[model samples]
Target: MPFEHYKEVDLSSRNTLGLPSVSQYLGAFHSVSDLQHAFEFARNLSLPCFVMGGGSNILLPEYLPGLALLSSDRSIDIMGDEVTVGAGASWDNLVAETLKNGLFGLENLSSIPGTAGAAPIQNIGAYGVELARFVVSVEALDLQNGLAVTLTVDDCQFEYRDSLFKRHPERFVVTRLTLKLSTRFAPILAYQDLQRLPAQITESAEGLRRAIQSIRAKKLPDYRVFGNVGSFFKNPTLMKSVIQTLEQAQVLNSNTRSAQGKVSAAALIQAAELGDLSVGQAGISPKHHLVLENRGGATLTDVLTLAHLIQEKVERRFGVTLEIEPQQLTQLIHAPNPKG
Candidate 1:
């Protein structure tokens, strides 16, 4: 049995929001054995447990109630063209490693922040490629039974920016992920920015990676210096009838229906003139309408207020609701109210 260590841990360093707080107890697990021991210890002590990966998508309040278990074991093994990575392994690192090995599918996802375990949590996607397309299986520890289980791709129940793990957070602690990648160069350049590259060039994976990185660098704020999560909101998808109503009202800037008939959320937000809206210290990113940034010393309350205001204004103007992407701290004063 692996021994578990617990202590009062500061969350400011663990979460990307950088909110100052202390978890009641915190521990790190390197292997399945370690995760099992930690789970048992939390159960014996009757404390709720929270699992964390790279901590990119969470907001912590001043005091968190339970133990936070961080996955810190970073290991990767490549067999033929299949790659197996520890949950704690950095997501970008895995992409880079795959590219170095001549694998092609992950190039479009380069530079995204977070760990491999968290990738499947949201089926992390960018520049036209998503993690779900390549994922073979995920290894997780069942917290309730203290048993390790391997989940196939279908078991993950992937959707746009969501997965079964998110819907059932308490059921499993992800330990590792396995992906199948291609050896030959095949690229997807359907995104507008990547489309600028000559068709012949984008036909190769290396060229696609360069194009994706270049586009992202120009569109997204550099996270190293700026304390901002990628996109603050998921583009609100709208039904065809809703789109027609908005169009008839002359309330839309531009509308593009997905093959599945959903309207684009970004287009709706831009049409609402919320691209440059600001509240207190938080504001919609001037560069991208869907992003909200905390301009120094901004509190979670400030961000939430701005988000609520945006939602309110959009609903008032076009009758559509905007959904936030990140998980907010439950105790924050501006936390979203329950829907009736």
Candidate 2:
């Protein structure tokens, strides 16, 4: 084996929500050689395998039930406006580094809590900026054959808030990310909140990042402080006519449009009057309705129940379904909850 493996590894602290989870087998791999060896080890045991990144966007099961792969490489290389980042490297830190290196374009994505691997996996976006815009190529391994592959940006098939990597999690494990950034500063202040920034702040990259970070600080609770996924439900994007009907019914407000044809998920959740609601120890975040928090010692069951209740209420009120944003480890997609 290219690297040693551990059994029954504790994963509570590995995830942002601090859920108590354990993996049947865990291996830290530095290169493709190590990844292949780990996969072979899992194959010998007839178990499944998955790439585990910063764990910020996943709801882990109590037990992972298979091989949990961890990327140990954390290198970041910069040449002019191009950068090559190890998958395990911090996404926020990468943004910061690029800004310090005199590169622009990632300022609006400041403070997103996840690793580089998770960025493309989620096609992370904030304040009108999506990670897909800067991605040139992604280096990954085809898990089935353990073959190294570099996928062009088009091969990624990035969408509103999704990517092929997310849809085909079982097929690939991201190893590195290559981005082509810009030397010129072209700030994207299209989002309403960003447009409110003082002209002086918009003139500099760090100032723009500070403004975005400040807005996030007010909207989301720090995961370290209160165990939670930043955004629990993705905004329901529909045809403008569909949302207009909901608006006529007094379900969503005209100001709630975050993007064209996308009504705010937080608005829908609030319309259900669920901001003050809680199920057991899991509660809808009072600060932002889209955030679900573990008040204290909350189980996955508690969170799911609370989320289901919100979904049902919103669906009944507006005839629109709310989709959970964080990936579910137990079931990738939500199945209908009969009781709801």
lDDT of each: 0.76, 0.84
Per-residue alpha-carbon lDDT of model 2 for 1-340, expressed as tens digits?
A: 3459889999889988888899887888778778777776766677677777888988988998877888888899998899999988999999999999999999999999989888998899999899999999999887555579999999999987799988887677888999999999999998888888899999999999999999999989888988997999888788878887878878777678755788898988887778888888889878888899988888888888998998899888877898888988764321211221
Highest-scoring model, TM-score: 2
lDDT of 1: 0.76
Q: Give the Cα error of residue 113 in candidate 2, in Å.
A: 0.4
lDDT of 1 by residue, 107-198 (tens): 98998888998899888988767899998999988655667899999999998888988777767679999999999877776665676788
Among all windows of ten consecutive residues in candidate 2, which has the lowest summed lDDT? 331-340
